[model samples]
Target: SQTIHQWPATLVQPVGSPLSLECTVEGTSNPNLYWYRQAAGRGLQLLFYSVGIGQISSEVPQNLSASRPQDRQFILSSKKLLLSDSGFYLCAWTGGAGAYGYTFGSGTRLTVV
Candidate 1:
């Protein structure tokens, strides 16, 4: 079976700090990975996506970045965190042959103080 893994579940950081979030997909190959953020009560905003290794595309201009090191692993990082950079971060993947939609990670609730 295929599964997605994300970390920390919840986080609380100061106004300026470093952040690293990771996601990995199992039982799939050549998957399409995506990173999204949801504000307190707003819709989702795509931060970045990768069609293949070293092929990331950014959708928003936030201070966040994403990377795909291996075929099934994806990483999101920030050199310095900001107060407005708090939200629910999600990592999703879609590339199977079936009609199943994207499978998302458990999500990380980030709060920057």
Candidate 2:
């Protein structure tokens, strides 16, 4: 059996609080990882994507950062939470690039108070 790990399924953070969400894709190497944000009744927004270690691309100019420390690990962190940052966070992994190969995590629902 294969195992995957994702953290902080739900979070209630203050306006000025710090945030850290983690996702890992085990049993795979050099996988493409993506972080997306979706607002209530709104379309999805791609936040970050990493194709390799130390390589990250930002889709939107928002208050968010993503890091790929290892070949199979990705982390999303915010220095300080903002009310606008409240949304549903999704992490997905794929074998390089392909719409059919994408596998998403459980996702995190963050609400900034």
Estimate the Cα RMSD of every predicted model relative to the unseen true structure: 1.5, 1.3
- Report every candidate's CA lDDT: 0.91, 0.89
What residue runs in model 1 are displaced by over 4 Å at the alpha carbon? Answer: 96-99
lDDT of 2 at 103: 83
Residue 81 lDDT, candidate 1, scale 0-100: 99
> In lDDT terms, which candidate is top?
1
- The lowest-lDDT stretch of 10 consecutive residues in candidate 1 is 93-102
Cα lDDT tens digits for candidate 1, 12-89: 998789999999999888999999999988998989989888889999788888889898889999999999999999
lDDT of 1 at 24: 93
Q: Which residue pairs collide in model 1, if any?
A: none
Q: For model 2, how does the per-residue alpha-carbon lDDT over 1-107 read when each residue is reduced to its tens digit?
A: 23457789999999988899999988878788899899999988889999999999999898889999998889999999999999999988888466656788889
